[model samples]
Target chain A: MRNIEVCFSPELIHLHELQGKIVVVVDIFRATSTMIAALANGIEEISTFSDLEECREMKDQGYLIAGERNGQTVEGFDLGNSPVAFLKKDYSGQKLAMTTTNGTLAISKSSAADEILIGAFPNLSATITYLQKQKKDVLIHCAGWKGRFNLEDSLYAGALVKSLESSHEADEDGALAMKSLFEKEGHQMKAYLSKASHAKRLQNHGIEADIDFCLTLDLYELVGKVENEKVRAI
Target chain B: MRNIEVCFSPELIHLHELQGKIVVVVDIFRATSTMIAALANGIEEISTFSDLEECREMKDQGYLIAGERNGQTVEGFDLGNSPVAFLKKDYSGQKLAMTTTNGTLAISKSSAADEILIGAFPNLSATITYLQKQKKDVLIHCAGWKGRFNLEDSLYAGALVKSLESSHEADEDGALAMKSLFEKEGHQMKAYLSKASHAKRLQNHGIEADIDFCLTLDLYELVGKVENEKVRAI
Candidate 1:
C-alpha cells in the first residue's frame, strides 16, 4: 500500500504534492463540523466554493447559500457556518452551496488530490476506518485559520495520525511529530482538546455549547467528497 | 502599548503585521535553545546571519563558527544547534557567529520590529517577566520549520501567551489560544512537549536527551538579540 502522511496546514504544503492520494480536508472550527451535521441531518448534496462571489452566484440560482464570513453568519445567505444550524431538521434533503473562511479554501486547494474528503474531529474515527480499508495514500490537510497554522486543526491532524498508526506512514518530520501526539493523546478526546484554541475561543465568547458538540466523534459515517464544485456527502 | 495580535502558523497572519512591536523570535528546535545555552555558558556575544555564507565569512575571523545544516552540525563548525553541546566549558567568553534553518530566518525577517528578543520554551518565564517590564507590543514570531508551521514552535508561542496572561492586552486570540494549551498541560512541560514535531524528530533520531534539556524553564538569564550581523546572547 502507498504510504500515507499528513500536511497539517494546506498553506504550509501544496495540494499538488498530494496527487493520487486520498486527501482529507479538515476545518474543525465550524466548516467541516457544519458539513458533517448537515449531511447527518439528511442534506441530500452540498456544493462547495472557495470564493464568496461564486457562492453568491450559486445562491442566485436557488441553491441554499450557506457559509460564514469572518466567523459569523452571512446576512443574506440561508445559513452560516454553525454546526448547530446545519443540524436543524429543516435542512434535511435540501441541497447546500457553501463557502467558508478556511475549510472551503482547503477543499478548493485539494483539487489535485486523487480523492478529497471532508475531515473533522467528530468523524475522525470513521474517516480513518473507511480510508484504511481502501488501501490508499492519505493526506490529512488541516484547514488552519485562513492558511496560517492553528492548534485545533493540527490537533485533529495528530489525532488522525494516531488513529491510522497501524496502516499509515508519517513520512515527513511534521507528520511524524503529529503521529507522536496522536499516540500520546488519542484516547483522551475531551481532555486532549480541553486546552485548544477553538475550545477557548468558543468558551470566552460564551458559545460554550458548540465545544461539546464539535468534539463528538464518529457522528457521521458518510464521507463528503469534492466533486463538480461542491462537497457531496456519499 | 501597541497590541500585538499574533496568529500562529497554518494561519495566514503575517509576521510583518507585528512591526513596530517587540517581536520575540522563538524557535525551540534548537536555535533559541542554543542561544540561551550559549549565553549561560559565558559566550560573550552572538551575531546572527540570515545567509550561511555570511556566517562562514564571520567564522574565518577567529569567531567560533556555530550552526546547523539540515539539523546537524555543519562541516568544520564548532556547534551543531544542540543546547547541551553549547554548555561545554570551552565556549566561555567566545564571540560566535551562528546560523540555522528556520530560527535565524525569522530573526533576519524581524529586523524591522521595534525591539527583537529571542524566545524559546526553555526560557519561558524569564522572557515574559522581561517583556512585562517593557511597554511595547509583543509579537512572538515562531521560527516555523522552513517557512511552514511546526507544532513545537506554535507550542512555544502558546507558552509565551500563557505566561503573559495577566497582561490582558497581549492575551487575545493568538495569546488566548496558546494560553489555553498551557492552562491544560503547561505544568507538565515534558509531557506536554512530547506531543510536538521537534521532540519527535529528536526522539526518532535517538537524540532525545536534548529534548529534555530544552524544556527547562528559566535555566538561563541571558537573552538572545539581533546584533551587527547575527542573533547572539548578551
Candidate 2:
C-alpha cells in the first residue's frame, strides 16, 4: 500500500521527503479553492507568486493579477483571493497570476514534489479519484495560516486521507489525527470551522459567503495540477 | 484572557514567539511522562541533553543517566524512557540526566521561553492548574517524533488546552483542533493511541506497559519546571 502523511504547515514541510510523492497542497480558506474555481470556470492557467509586487507585475504580461494579504485583496490587484470572484466571470483563454499569504508560499515551497495538486473542498471528489488512480505515496500539505496550523486545510487533508485510506495507509501522526478529526467533525464542517481562527478572520473581513462557498464539497470535477510553477486543470 | 497555542512540532517552534509564554514541552509516549514519574517518585533535579554521549557522560558526575532513541533504550544507559522504570524504586536525592530522540531536542530548542514546564497525561491537572494560576500565555510544544507531528503529545496538549479553556482562549488552530481531539478521544486514549506511530514503535519494543502508564491521567500533581537547564518539581 502507498503511504499517506500530512505536513500541517509549509514551515513543517522540510521534515517531509517530496521527491517521489504526490503533494496535494490545500489552502481551504481561499487560495487553492480560488485556483480550482478559476481553472474550472475557464481561466486557462494560474501562476502563483509569493511576492505581491511580483504578482502585480504580471498584469503587464497580460495576466490577470490576483493577490491577497491578511485576507484582504491587495491594493491595485485585478482580483482578490476569492473563489466566488473567479466564478463570476469566464476568462476563457486568459491566464492568472496570483499570490496569497499562505497558499502561494506553500506552492513555492512544494516545488520539489514529483507532482503538485491543488486541493480544496470544491474539487474534493476529483482529487480523491485522481489520487486513488495514481497509486503513489501522498503528502497532503496544509497551507496553514502563516506557518501555523489551521482547521479548514487540515480538515480537508483529513477528508482526503479518509477517502484514500482504502489504498493508502497513513504514515504519520498528523495524518492519523486529521483522519480522526474529520471522522468526528466532518458532518458539520461550516459550523465546526466557524471556531477556526482563519474563518473568524475572514468573517471579520465580511467574507462569510466565501467561507461557505469554499467549504462546499465536490462542486466541480476539476483537478488542478502544478506544472512548471503554473497550475492548470488536468 | 490568556491565550493558548500549540506548536505541533519542535520544527515549527521558530514560527512561535516563546519569550513571554509558558512553554509546556510534552513527549507523552515516554520522555516527559518519565520525567514526571521520576520527580513524583523522589528523583531530584532532571537535566536533559539532546546528545546521547552528553547524557551518558553525566554518569561520571553521579547523575542517573537515561537515554532513548527511536523508542528504544540506549545500550549503556541506566534506564530507558519509561515512567514505569522510575516508579520501580525511589532514587531519593539522586539527579537524572536524560536524553531522548524528541523530548530533549524540544527542551533544548525551547530555552527562550519565560518558563518551561514539562507536561504529560500523568501531570495533566498540575500543569493546567499552574498555567491557570500563572495567568500567562501558554505555548504547548509537542516533542513530536523526529521533528514531525505525533499523536500522543498532541493529545496531551489538547487535554491541557481543554482544561484551561475557561481561562484561556485558544489562539491558534492547532490548539482548537487538539482541544477537539482530546474531547473526542480522551476517554479512549489507550485504544486511540494504539494507532499512533510511536505507540506502535514502542509496542514493537515490548514496552506496552509504559504506553498504558503514560496515558494515565493525573497520576501525580507534580509540575516539573525548568530553570537553568534543570527540571525540578515545583
Candidate 3:
C-alpha cells in the first residue's frame, strides 16, 4: 500500500523523509497555479530559484522573470505572481525564471526527493492521474505562508489525497488532520477558503480574482516536474 | 473577541507569536493527564523538569519522581507515566518531581507566555472554566511526539476550542483545522484515537487501558497552573 502524507507547511520540510518519495509541492494560492497556467499558455520551461538575485541574473540572460515576495511583485520583473498574468501569453521557445516566498523555497528544500511534481487546484486531475500511474508513496508538501501553516495549500493537499484512488495510510497527524479538514470542507472550498489568512491577505491587496482562479480545478492538463532547477511540463 | 490558536506541534511554537497569550499546554496521552490525576488525588504541587538529571536530583531530595522517555518509565523513578498510577495515592502536602519526553519539554519552551495552564481531557471542564474566566487570547500548545505532530494532543486542543463558549477566532489554519477535526470526531473520540500512532505505541506496551483513562472527560475538577517550575492546582 502506498502511504500518503501531507506536510502542512514549509516548516515541516525537514521533518519529512523525502528520499525515494514522490513529492507534490503545493502552493495553491498562486505559485503552482501560475506555473500550471504558464505551461498551458506556452511558456517553454520555468526555472525556479529560491534567491531573488539568481532569478534576476537569469532575467538578465534574456529570460522572462516572474516572482513575488510578501505578495508583491518583484521590481523589474517581467510579470507578477499572478496566474492571470501568465494567461493568454505565448512564449513557445522562451524560458521563465521564477521565485516566490514559499513555493520555490519548498521546491529547493525538497531536492532530496526521487521525483518532484508541482500541484495546484488548476492541475488537480492531471496531478492525481500522474500519481495514480506512479504508485509510489506520495508526500504532499504545502508551501505555507512564510514558514507558517496556511489553509489554501493544505486544503489543496487534502483535495489531492481525497482524489487518489489507491489505498494509503497517513504518515502523521498532519496528514490525517488535513484529510479530515478536506473531507469536511471540500464541497464548500471556495466559501471556506475565503476565510483563510492568506486569502484575506491577498484580498486586502485587491487580488481576490487570483484566489478565485487558483481555486478553480483542472484548468490545465499538464503535470509540472522539476528537472535541472526548473519546472517543465511532463 | 479573543483569538485562539492551537500550535499542533513544538515545530509550530516558534511560528506563533505566543507573547502575552495564555498558553494551554496539552499532552493528553499521559503527562498532563497524570498531572491532573496527581493534583486531583491530593498532591500539593508537581515540579516539572525537562532534564533527567534535574528530575533525579529532586527524587534524591525525597520528592516522588515520575517520568518517561520513549514511553517507558524512568529507572529509579517512583512511578510510571500512566495517569492511573497517580490514582488512589495519598500525598496531601507532598511534592512530585516530573519529566517526560514531550510534555515538560513543551512547558520549558513556552516560558515566554503570560500564563501557562496544564491541560488534559481529565480536566476538560475545569480547563474550559478557567479559560473562560481569564478572557485572554488563548494558544493551545500541543506536546506532540518528540517535536513532530501527534493526534491525541491536537484532538484535545480541538476539544478545548470546541468547549469554549466565548466569541473567538482561530489565529491560524492549524487552529481552524483542529477545531474542525474536533467537531467532526468529538463524539467518537475513543474509537478515533485508537488509530493514532501514539495509541499504537502505548498499546504495544500493553497499556491500552491508559488510553481509555486518558480519553475520559472531566475525571478531575482541577486546573493546573505552572509557577516556579511546578504545577499547582489553581
Candidate maximizing DockQ: 2
For candidate 2, lDDT tens digit of each residue in B92-181?
A: 999999887688889988999999999988888888888889968999999988888889888988898899989999857889899888
- Model 3, A155-228: lDDT tens digits are 88778777773566764566777777789888888788766565677788877778788889888888999887
Q: Provide C-alpha RMSD values for all models, in order.
A: 4.7, 1.7, 1.7
Task: For model 2, name the residue pairs that clash.
Answer: none
Residues B45-139, candidate 1: write the lDDT tens digits: 88776677888888778888887765667787877777888765756768888877667677776767778888876667777777888877788
Instruction: Select the stronger candidate by DockQ from 2 and 3.
Output: 2
Displacement of residue A89 (Cα, Å) in model 3 is 2.3
Candidate 3 per-residue lDDT over residues B1-234, each given as its tens digit:
788888867777888787888999988878888898899888899988778888889977889898776667888888878888777567788889987767888898788999999998988998888888876889999998777777888889888877773566764677777788899878898777665565676788877778888899988788999987789998
- What is candidate 2's lDDT per residue for A1-234, written digit by digit as tens? 999999989888988899999999999888899999999889989998887888899999999999777667888888888889887878899999988768888998899999999999988999999999986899999999888888999999999999999999985789889998999899999888877666777799878788888989999998999998899999
Better structure of 1 and 3 per lDDT: 3
By DockQ thresholds, what CAPRI class is model 2? medium
lDDT of 1 by residue, A1-234 (tens): 356566655666652377778988888776887888888887778887778888888877768888666557678888876787766576666788888767767887788888888887667777877888876888888887655555566667777776776887665545655655555555665665555555666666554556667777777777777787667777
Worst 10 residues of 1 chain A by lDDT: A176-185
Best by lDDT: 2
How far does residue B116 in candidate 1 sit from its true spot (Å)?
A: 1.5
